[model samples]
Target chain A: MRITNFLFDKVGKWSKQFSNLPDRYIKRAMEQVYWRNPKGIQYKPNAVVKRKKYHFSVHRPWTGEFRQENSPGRLHPKVFVEPIKEWSFFRGDRVEILVGKDKGKQGIIKQIFQERNWVIVEGLNCKLKQIGDDKEFSGVYIQEEKPLLVTTDVKLVDPSDLTATTIEWRFTEDGDKVRVSTRTGRIIPIPASVEETIDYKTKATYLEQPKDTKADAVTEITFEPKLATFEMDIMEKMGIKDDRVPPKSFWY
Target chain B: MANLRVMCKLLKNLNISNVKAHSIPSDRRYKNWGAQEVKSGRSWKKEELRLKSNSDLHKYVLLKERNMLLTMEEEAKAQIQLFPSPERIDKVEDSMENLESVIRERNVAYHKLETGRTGERPYKMSKNAFGLRYRHEMSEYTMPKHMNKDWYEEFRSYKHDRYTEQFLLKYREKSYVSKRRQQIRDFNHVIHLLNRFPDMDMQALKEQYPNVDIEKAKASRKYGGHFAPK
Candidate 1:
């Protein structure tokens, strides 16, 4: 099986992109394996009894809340998400609400849940949730933004007219893919905020940590083609020599 | 006892500090202790590793980083303290894997150009004693298969017998049952999706489940929603 199929099959690219965590880390943190075949000569060499499917919610797969929701022995109804050819909505894109009380109002996308074709618009489509109500205490109510279906509940806003417009994917003369407004026939530029993540606003402006390799050192091209294998080259560079070659080996 | 105490005092007064090569220094432990979070950039990409020389890639930087992270994690567990940035281990591992893959690619290209064969370990689909087919990676030995009596004794292939045939029949049936169940589950799920989203893109659905027969699924009773005829 392909590695991506097992690792990030359920996690949509947009959902995990904002967290700025490696795919390996997310897979390691979220997997709940109950049993696995031990290393030995066995009938089944690599049999792994693990949770094959997960219920994607507003909480990300690596979060504690998601674990609580998908705790052991708790089964959730299967969610059927309509498959879309391409994901057009992204964080910081101006979108108009097409459903609910917030219909016709425009807001920027704060988060995306691509697995369910869901997005939460900033300050729009909110519901009041009561928290920590007690016998003697009045509960505090807070406004929580609810996820809206991107297919039926929102439309991208055309930058030229600032109105909701249908969009189509098109290519420019330079071969760069762009989103074009179908109504105005204008190119709706993707905002710079698309690159914003929890760690930094953009990769170029990311503050290098104490352990980060310097940028120039990483980009330096030090490789020179040679008529030798990696081992041969390394051994030659290290001045290691092995002249004895009388042993014959067989493979079965 | 007094003389031993005086010796201990003398030893203490000498200010002798025991240092070991493997142990993390006490000063570094103090720095790592009680830290809530540790920040780091992403791991090395394949493109970056490709630009590196063979000697530079062979250095033990990635291995040392992994060993240090593992040591720190073990220490944190032993002390019942939080391990800051456990993801750093994954980052280091990811870099190591990328570095290995890049080296493998270069090696494969060189082998293909020189010897017209991949330099990787050879494997073949062979049956075990149980008659189950598995990929058997070939290993080097001093003796050939004809002369190796121990190898034959250990890895003897399945012999035809009544009990063996019955076991194979049951195993195949079990595999077929699981496969059939999976196909049925996908069929029902596709029908549900079609029922829910009547105007859903058919091409996308077909692309998602290439095995499912969409025309047959549309003809099922569960394909349409419960509503009065318009």
Candidate 2:
């Protein structure tokens, strides 16, 4: 497989779920193809030379910062990201800090970088930095919350008791998967806000754009199975008669 | 200047809006030309397209949208400005793909029910001049293979030759070297991963690099950390 396909796999499902963009769009926006095989037969057919590795930091792959970080010929060290079996953390998830000054303090998950198993809590694990500091003036300080590893730096909070607890994925009698708090054995429901994206809060609330097909129109089924191929059906509907047979031809 | 102004007046009165530019009738421009982003819904799902009739599929006016997007993208490139919501192109393309697939499915279903064969284009796995196997998509010709001198001239069926024999030897050697290098690289990468993340998920590592022997990688000299043993 190509490195582009490999990098595409690195992008976590839950991490990009909030974008609400199609997978194809994300792949198109993020990939930097330096060279590709032109339209002709060659020794190496369909060969492409593109950036092999990327520095996946706090910056999203589709952002300007990510492009800058992964600028041509500027290679970063290999990142050893632990492979996760299943992603449980999501946007709007309440989690407690485990290894910082804000330890035991709970905050909602504001952003996630599943590439590195990192998540940014709403207002926790912050570090102050001074920007544009010069001799003539003391620069203003800004607090930025850094990402924390979901494995060691944070734990999900059980909504039932409002305390940090380990959770296990369990299926109910109805066959719906739910995250159950192991400490209290109570079902911590996934929030409705999980479906929130940059475009719209929910699918129902999405405002229809000018080019968008109406919901009712899309749902209306007009298909009736016919004993003809697509082209045949279309020609019949258009009232085009073709009785002349094609000339004899051979296939090698 | 006065003559130019008069010409402009005449042109305005003539109503040149109907004039086609490069075969495109509409003024090729995006609706949200100056906006920060162009918001749109996701691509039409295959399930949704399957419900549409043949005429509805034929009436799908996606070509104009594609043309407009290409024009806007070119303009943005020329001006060095960010093309807002580039994803619209991808969405359109994805929807087009879904539409075509849905149409193909219907056609295939009809053909299979009638002819007891997949109505797809016929192809066969055949060797090329270089002795490499590729799917040869069969095409219609006016005459049989033996009689079609033009086809034979163009294709030149594979034949054993001294030059080709030597070429194949070197090509196979090159391929083998690259394949070996790739295996070594994968092994080294796995070792480095283990060194950095000792407690990493083994299943994931195995899944990612299925070719690398996990036990062999662990037993390598470079596997452990460079720390003093307690």
Candidate 3:
């Protein structure tokens, strides 16, 4: 298939291209001129925005992956600056919800937040107390506001997988640094690039379940934290095509 | 620590500012010929960049682009084969383009700041005869076509078909939460890289960021380098 190079040019040309439309629509589209691809720069990933760095307001739009947990109509996310616990690092490390209804989910850690903590694990453990009439009162009490852990809980992944494709650094006596499947002893090489940058995860590390990878089916997400930094930046700062994001309290 | 410093100084002494000599034993020409500049490196990081003023930033960006262009020119001058990926130069060009645009925007903002135009008056938006809608801003859009304010209002209510709808569906994609999340993820990832391989070479960071001062990153408490427990 031939690739389209529309992104090579800014969409502002649309302002002059489509000069006739409804006022409201035109207004919406006008706002879009500043909103959509306002600038071209890889500013998101590998970023630090605490003080000096420029920080733009993030827009919320549903990425299809978020539906695995909550529907758009009923969203309860959490936001925060740090994981509640220090020792609780990702992939088993400490984790906390930074936004939404279930703002704080502790204990389950060692996972990465793709977009929000809600997407990682069912973490918001606090129960919301709804006061009701005397007829419904079994006594004054409280309940868990939401879950504390979901399938999306952050976790740590192994780096050995990345080095598998890397060129051999040391060779004393044994074979090359490439790994063999622990069970079947099959070498899993991407076979695309001989360069060291090629990241080939051995079966022992990344077990791509057919269900999850199969496009036709609704794949179940297993608790696997051994993932790689595939997409450099999914955020706007990164000059990419994806234009999707989850609402507030997803993750910090 | 002192050895790398000495080597760094020695490399500098050679008067080859753009190239660095490798200390690695793997290079066959460690004694005969030396490590010429196969690849120089990327430029400064955000923290260093933040320290620079607006003019300095512009000059720095221009210097980088010019240096990169000169480097590419030198490659041809040496009669060596052109880089397999000339897009590397394109990437450099793209960065220069971005820097120039950002500077231009900042200059305009500065001009606005100078003029004492504090609060921006809300401008009305409408479509013209060509089904195109634009914000009527007198600040810059005061030309011949833009002056046709009536033409814009007249066709401001036209319908668009499916094909037209696709190209017009442009909108900002990221939000505060998502961008923050991704940044946190990337930061944690750097930390994770340090944690997992405390013994990993600090020089590797130089490969990832040849221009960035790795010494600063090393000094950071967050840097996951191996050290004797206190």
- Among these predictions, the greatest DockQ belongs to 2
lDDT of 3 by residue, B1-230 (tens): 22111111000111113332244367543222222323222222233223323423323433544564566557666866443322234334444555455444444454466674433343657443333465544332333545567645643444676644553443123355555565455444445555554545565433433334545545667776668999
lDDT tens string, model 2, A147-237?
A: 9999789999999889999888899999999999999999988888888888667666666565566665666678897889989988998
Candidate 1 structure quality by residue, lDDT tens digits, A1-252: 422234334788988888878889888888889999998677778899887777788988888898888788888887778888889999999999999999999999999999889999999999999999999998999999999998899999998889999899999999999999999999989988887888777665676664566665666678999988999999898899978887999989
Per-model fnat list: 0.53, 0.52, 0.00
Q: By DockQ thresholds, what CAPRI class is model 2?
A: acceptable
Across A37-137, the per-residue lDDT of candidate 3 in tens digits comes to 33222223224321111111111111223222333234333232121111212233233454555444344332232222232333444555655538756
Top lDDT model:
1
Q: What is the per-residue lDDT of model 1 for residues B1-230, given as tens digits with 9 covering 90 to 100?
A: 22121111000111112323367677765675679778766777788789988988876667777877899899899999989878888888888888899999999999999999998999999877667889999999999999999998888867878877887899899988977777787788889889889889898888777778999998998888788989
Q: Chain A in model 1: its TM-score? A: 0.91
True contacts kept of 1: 0.53
Candidate 1: residue A163 Cα off by (Å): 1.6
Collision pairs in model 2: none
Better of 1 and 3 by TM-score: 1
TM-score of chain B of each: 0.78, 0.80, 0.30
Off by over 4 Å in 2: A2-9, B1-31
- Superior candidate under DockQ, 1 versus 3: 1
